[model samples]
Target: MSKKGKKPADSPATERPRPIASTVAPPPARSAPVTSASSPPTAPPKPTQAAPPDALIWFDKRVKITLGVFVGIFLLFVLFKWHYISLPAWNEILPDGGPAKRGLVAGTPKRIRMDDYAVGAPWILSNANTGFKTENEAVGGLKTPLLTLPVKHPIIIFKIGYWGFMFLDVERGYSWMYNSSPLILLLGTFLFFLLVSKNQYWLSLTGALTLFLSSGTVRWSFIPSSMIGYCGLAFVGAVYLLRSTNPKVYIPVAFGLIWIIVSFAITLYPPYQIPMAYLFIFLLIGYVLNERKLVFPPKSVLVKLISLAGALLVAGFVAYLFKSDVDETVKAVSGTVYPGKRSETGGTGFIANWYSEYYSWFFDDQQFPKGWLNICELSHYLNFVPVVSPLAIALFAFTRRIDWMLVGAMAFVVLMWLWMEVGYPEAIAKATLMSMVPTRRGQIPMGVGGIVLLFLYLAALRNVSLSDLKQAIPVWFTPVAIVGIVAFVVYTAYVNINDAEGMLRTDQTFMPVLFFILMNGLLLFSLNIRYRMALFCGGIILFLLPNLKANPLSKGLTPLTENLVYQNVKTLVDKDPDARWIVNGSQFVTYMVTATGAKQITGVKYIPNRKQIFSVLDPTMKRDSAYNRYAHVTFQTYINGAQGDTTILAQQYEDGYVIAGDPCSPKFKKLNVKYMLYDHAPQIPYEVRCMKKAVELGSMTIYERID
Candidate 1:
């Protein structure tokens, strides 16, 4: 019906109010153009993403591939050298040698005894005798609480077996187990340079030489902890280098590295583990932050991080099967042993020295006649020149020419050193949930970081010209160099003059100090000339020269398997396989007896069990004295022959060792010490008659118990 007043259906009002006249007009329709039907329909433009940066292309593809192949070959060479290639050298070292060839030097008791129990001997012995259980005889008859855990670096143990088995014939009593540690380090150093030096083969070679030949690396060459640390660092370098190649490969490579690093870390004690974990985290974070300018991490990066965290958690759980072992070690070490007691310079000595010694930088050789300082920790300074890396880092940072990655590395070095040397870092560590961390282990990172920083500094200097040096030194380079040289010279002169007049017989201080000064001077000159390559080569030379003289075989191990004392002890052990024995001689004698499969009344390396000590010692044994300090059921033994004297006999009783002169004593019987070897025998018929004679070898007289 047509009704405007009633809004008829045909009217404008009824026709949806003229479509409400849109305020925002619709897009104008295109006019129909006179085009042919043959024209193709236009396609829509495709969405695109920003291309990844190529700023990381430091090496040519050909060079990278060649070096990678070389690395593979080198690795193979090392493995072959460890196995088949060792034959020529073996034959040359000992003519007509069968399986029984000369092995590497017997190092300190920690290396000879503790390391063998931890990873070396157990692996060799287990493989040698199929029925031999490592768990039952780890570090002697008494079990090491830590070794019971799954975290004993089985990867390292397996690696040792794979590469060391051919040459290390346990049946023939070959003791070249520790020799592989140095070789591993050498391989690791090469890998580190290959990854980090950006295909600069010369730099890589120089760096490898500098690191492998460093006194610290040499001195602690026998320790798997140090070796593991180096390997972890090499993998870290690989991860850093590979992340830039392709994102598709980055995730898997990074994760793979995490697995390897964590595996290496978990196999050993905490000293190496904590630092490596920290380095991985730091490098990952720094890389992500530096690569992506975005403040917040992307979802992909977040996912990778979460995955890493989960993997690390799983690894940690697997490495330490039970947390109780770690806890027990913490509890024990915090009590009255060498770890807990006041050292020579007070407070746990150099081993657990919470405070760094002021003179640590000066000590290179700690061997008897050649060393100025006898401190073990100070050996880390071998061939290390005093150039103040922090100062250089600070200068670069202020100039804003420094890469953040290197800055982070240097920061780690400084942080680790401070953690080891100063009180504050350890205080913070203890205050946090990481209270169980042995702060001494921080030195691993310190050593590694220092080495890395040295390389980075040299790498940075490689590009600097004389003009750049002139501009960078800020008009004070020459005067500063002169002053530094003169100051060091004057300091050395004063030290030498004072030392010559002191109680020391021969003045060994001047030569080292002079060498140090000369090295610093040469480095400073190289800085002036921008000859970093020369300086690095000189550094290698400086590090290699002093430590070239091999570590003298640990006393009493001139010939490791065929020593006279070891043979005598082995005979007695072979007779009564079940009976325990005590050696009234040096720690080396104890080591020899233990190596021969004899169950020692007291352990050769570690502290003995407290309960065992209490069972054998007098009831009046003081809790705070040396007797208590030297007592444990595990590894504590007489350090040397201290028979006849009351205190020494008391110490022997406390340590669970038999009193040499009194084999018939109640304590000896209680401990079941069925045999004794007296190196410094007291000529008394009463004492001699108490035990049945079992032949004398050299200064030692073997005896069988006759109650």
Candidate 2:
């Protein structure tokens, strides 16, 4: 045979070539390399298998499902068996050793949130039994039934999750009260995962927990917290409808969009809602621009547009159904003297904005310094965005690339900070409709934006390599970022130190310092891809530290409802369902009376009743500014007025009023005041003779009108 045609001695000449495994394959196994006789033939090296994926990556793939299950179980347990409601705080007003004293299963209830314990909760429970209506007969007079559906007021019928439970049964709906905070947290986390993190489960959970557990959400865990979740849901729904090609997703997304819009509109808290709307608008624009290809494919454009338009039309129709009720409420609220026509140009509460998050941990049980704001007012999100902004700027500047989401988030936050720290012009404020957003209320958007910015920056960091970072960013950037962060922290500390009046103790500074260092450290680690998991885990830990004990884990509503005084009031109202009541003591008594289904003239007023209620007390309009606004009316007898006269003493507080009057007055009679709750006996004999005591427990006394 010719040498060129000859086969190797050990080869099977008839063996056919193996089929290629892929379009590209390793060069057909090379013939064994020629070996010298001196070197024994070595076994051909084994093909290398790919190293197993890192364990953490495996965990990451399933972590979302695992964490989701955990959250679901925790939610169900708390909703049915235990809750974190602050109803136990009502114990402070109950007589010592009274039959209905609220008991705690875990943490202490926060008295600082009387609005929740003494007012909002009672109103919700009362409304549950009385039927959810725009007008709550339990409060104000029947003709002037208090507007119970506005602001943070929780009318179960309008509340999303709670309303569903009411369909099952009223008790189930009532029990669902505890579900609000946890449900908000879950919704925020779930929606943020889809909207901001691109389904990055761990990052979304961390951000949501941090944001919702912050002082603002924990203390004002009603409208503000709900707004965050609803906004997130709306954004996610909009994005899904915009990008989805499947017909199955369209219906659910559309329904969710409608639900979120209606719920958000009904919330009626413009302070938080307006700023949040501005932030989301910025986010939506940036998101669309960034994901233009996915969100705006020409082939799917018609379907997407139709789906969105249909959803919005339905939502508009639903809103139109409530137009009459909403208009009446708007008119009543606008006519009030306090929050009515209240406009702001920002540049207020700067110190609180900067340092309140750090200092608020200490003030949860006590009043914040200056006594101008309570714990809830002082609460703010522990946002690391300010510290991380420099790093983000440097990254984008060096790489010559921009992340629109980060830019959008940073823009919103920066604008809010400017509005808060340096007053904005009145013209700009009015034009943007941000005048409705007081600087103090601006924290909601700023805090929410900070969290979004943090996660977006983290998502962006994943696309960057170490080589690109090293080549683009100078080594000195780390120290500069550290120094800037430290300076900001120190400035906040200094501001509080100067103004705290000994309230910010040295020991209290430890947590802020530790958290500052840890948070910045995690942001610094974001520069290196290898430490990404560490950064996420560490960030979650730091965020969780301050909020671990924010609320108590208690069971049931007995703490506020089962007491002897409440039962007695319930009995009295059961006999005379049409009777009206007036409380002559603490505002707590007023709300408690309202909780028993008794018509309370002095309960928290949702809107001023100028013509029927307030005008009767101040007919001459002498104190129109005082009685012409929302207030919790309290009565105190004074000898100055005629035997049956009343005078509005002061309306200095937005939510309260001091009225020096005789409960036996014709004004009270005209209002149909049939019962009086007192913390003390009347000192005036004439006032004493007007009513006879009917129920007494400890210091609280209930009297029936005798006139």
Candidate 3:
């Protein structure tokens, strides 16, 4: 293939699993003597690949370790989610009964439309002709969807015991599917470990478990982050397929690439399609440069062009099915206030004006590219997913020779850095112009970078060249690696000190830091487990025990949360036929609908009508205008001009009542929200003010619509 100017990858031999029989020849024999005009070249016999007795032992041990790790992980999750020990069914924040009222499990347009309030109802519940419906620009003509199947249901279903759940699988919780990606990402880690490591099974499982349950993976699992997950899924396939020295590997890799592209249509980040395309180009270019194999193989650029074009065609066809209004989609997505202020200034009044213009994009020395931007402005940008500072991590490749995972990792680094490059202050104008979040939304690259570092470190540790370590006699590098691991852990811990507050604030931040600490700690300790299992286990697990309890699913929760759960009970019922009323003291919406035979909106989304709401529960603020009450709500934005209609929308007795926070912040005064419908506010500001307790239904408090 090389003699023909063909890429090594394009060679028919590059994609399949290499034969490993002892009698089989080594896949590459590039050292064969070249035939010249002056001399006859003797054909050297093929190099054998017979497995040594020790190789079988190594393989078996690796598999054993992998199984043990997998089982341990599964058990940990199962134990935490053993049974929902949550508090009694009380009112949930932004109480609403959406899709359940519409006879569905939530995530439907009926639910999302009301909850998100950012899009038109029709566009959200597209049930019309063709595939999915979408628009390229805010007001562009309707276009086809990008995915092959209607992306309406891009989740998976798992029947774990009696609890059947849908994830990324639209059939279940629509917007709640972040767990699926971790599983796929684990496969990539496993295959990578398979590529390195003397105790292959132990190495593969260790990396796989880390990737699978990585803090970032779990924290991001709740939202609609399937794009990252799907990409990860594809990355696994691509790495394995490309690394093989046989043809079978290429076929799947090609298909995997197509699948990766196809999945992008369903994401909020539509423009990312361009970068993803570039990623494919990146892979092809790498293969061509390294192995001198044309990335698309069949000896011609035409085939590659056709294949790529076909993928684009499929995407276009998918795009056509959308009938949604472009304005709605773009507004729903691009309307964030970066630095805490609107990117565009216009319209509205007073609080609305203030809200639309309040600024928070302050430049922090820590965030700046060397802390250059010190501007204070209100703009729409995104908070980055917490990951290690990518710059410090990129030093790996310069420090060592590269392999398959290493290459994929390098690509990941580029993409993640590209994400930061695309956003940050340096590229604000360009990113805002595109209506995309700062490059942080593309955190898959960060994840890939992590995987790369893990692999590089492990590869260095587990290399067979260190015969002393492989044979268990220990090597010179072992002590150095140990010291290196210790320093890395301590330095990372120091980096975390600055971030500890953020980590403490949310499970999202805490998990990543804790995992980094533990992973390094484990890697360090695992190498010398004989004398310190108790010490290492105690140190790491003790810190983890407190944090693990924070997961709502974990056992032995605090009684305060338990008692609160027992205090609130809300329900739906057709009781007292004349009223056919829906009443609740519980948190569950489904119970409300099932108990009361009335229509109720399920879930929460911003609505412009908040200013007109009249509260019936609170006596102290009954006369306050909805507009007056609304402005006091700290977390919300004014939907209409502060000058717009301040008149109360619903009379105290007519329309259904809404359940919300108390009169603590000026928000209640701004909106003139007439209701004080609770005994307590457990969340933030609302909790500050006391209210009359309704009824303790199973642990949740039920408030009343006061007069």
Candidate 4:
């Protein structure tokens, strides 16, 4: 034993104090036996300090100014090109009359109405009373809801106009929102990057451009739900990534972002947003592990949990507001339509061929008769960028330097896509949440994941060394997998005889070749990482350019409001303000007439009545056909051609258009078809038919019906 007064080397005075909670007391000192010729006292450990904020790395002053200038220029350019600044008359905004083609309508001068007309028609035409109204068969009405339900997604196009263009008149507001939706995407990307990157202007700019220029974005640019859904996903990612050493700053921001996430989630379109939701969830988990070791210090945990609870409550309330409508829409869309079931004899289910044609993005001259009419929404449109970023992610994973949360998020998306394609059992798909989203929409999440991983890969590379590269390179399985991808693509192409039969377009043959080149570029970079980023950047730019220019930016000046037929129809509606009408020959004509303050028996809507609205126009259509299943007016034309159907042939209605049949009919009088608008004088079965020629405006002929 040591002398009574002598203290031990490992005694309290010589020992390091453990970090303690404020409520806990320190232990009382204790004496210990002395050791031989003494070792030096050990030093106390330094208290841990959080790392400097990572978001600061991107906040360069010059980058902000440059991005601002570029954005201002872009906005000004679009404004001038689209004639939005000076403002055209509402009548000149969008064309109303044009010739119809098979599988095409002349809504706009060019046949670009897949979005400009089809989805946007209701908004531009202001079909306020178009949804499920009373069952009035006198006007060719039905007992069932005319619309599917929860009209929010379809009406979002109109809402954008209603809210965003408050400065302009009603018609122009819709026209503006329809044409300038790309700006919304750009704005969302900027806000997202600003929050996540801490105003890292360059990164924000790149990401915004990447997302905005993506083929899916370009294809869905006119559809507000698509862009709005993307904005929600971006908001989620931004909020998830926010963190700071200072709790005061980050904690409040975190709470606020949580609320934002809840709002965004409630507004989500399952097709695009579900995958992104899962992706951000993984990213959030990863961020926690990387930054906080999955343990937010006790105080932080309490605040985050409270915030989450509050957000969920708010989201629940919001969802309840539209829950009924959404449920009905879900049921209707899942029925026998393009993306729906087929006949019992087993023709291809409406959207099954489109799903099978997923590989069009890989082919140069690929065609998708049933896919997004814009031709840019194919999964592979981003070319090698999607393929290569995942490789980089895998490389980092192999070396154990990867942030697995990010990896897990991306891996889940790939798995979900595969799950859908291979026809896994529903139990498995549902368990994995793959069945919740449409198979076609998987591209959106995969595209987002690819971009996120690209940013992650770049960040990882910044601190990596040659030794790290050496360590990561030996993971030969990644390269082997890439080879396997190439082989599978070639074998599939050969087996399908896509080469000789030209079933697959050969125009884009360079894409698969480009994938190899990108892979080679990555290999080249392992030797030296400093300069090859430009090559990859160039490759990305090349992939983006085609889709970016899919529609003319200058066309924004030429609105969809203008047309010879709209003016004529408006005049007719002005004469008899109380009557409802129907148009024959063209859906665009119907939309134009609707825009002129007329009620339509049918027009373009996201979910048209499924219980055979076409049967109202042609009684024979009560029997099921493509028209009833598709619930589109254009399907009537096809059915008319296919079956030589004369049920509607020569049938005359007062809204405008007389078939070769008898004009004086009790059905026409009961329907209150006051005026018939047609391209030519129709054959009157008898002179006693109380139909008088009203006016002839060029190719359009108006006939007033007096029973």
Looking at model 2, the pairs that clash are 100-563
Q: Which prediction has more favorable TM-score, 2 or 3? A: 2
TM-scores, in order shown?
0.64, 0.83, 0.46, 0.67
Task: Report the number of the highest-TM-score candidate.
Answer: 2
Highest lDDT scorer: 2
RMSD of candidate 2 to the true fold? 9.9
Cα lDDT tens digits, model 2, 1-707, are 01222222212122222211101122345566788999997998654222121111122324446556646865675456465666777776675564333556777777766766777767776765466555664544332332442222333234664553445444345445446645665665555653454344555566666665666676665447778878877887776666555666656677777777777767767888888877888888887777665555534666656776887777666566566445666776777776787678998855365656665656655656765466667676766776768777876787676667778889998899888888789998888888888877888777877877877776566445556457667778777777777787777677676667787876678777767665666676335545564566565656556665766766667776677778888888889877888788777777887788677777787665655566677767787777666678777766555543546558748767777777787777887788888888777667867788888877778888888
Candidate 4 lDDT over 1-707, as tens digits, reads: 12233332322223232111111122454455455567666555433222233232232344456557655764554344342111122233333344221112112222333345433443344433233232222122232222322133432322333343435444344445544455555655555544433333445566667766665565554343334434534444344434443455454555555544554544435555666667666765665555463235534556656655665566556556545545655465555344443111111112322222224343332354434333444432233344444565655555565555446556754654454355456666566555655555566665566566565444344335555456557656655755755664454434334433454554454455445445444533245655554555555555566654444333332233345666666677777765655554455555556555565554443433434333344565443334333333421221233544233532122122223223344544555667656544443335225767676766566667766
Off by over 4 Å in 2: 1-71, 74-81, 99-101, 140-158, 168-172, 351-353, 356-363, 482-493, 505-515, 525-530, 610-622, 639-652, 698-700
- How well does model 2 score by local distance difference test? 0.65
The TM-score obtained by model 2 is 0.83
Q: Decide which is better by TM-score, 2 or 4.
A: 2
Q: What tens digits encode model 3's per-residue C-alpha lDDT throughout 503-581?
A: 2233333444454444444444124444232343244333322322211331221111122321132121122211111
Model 4 TM-score is 0.67
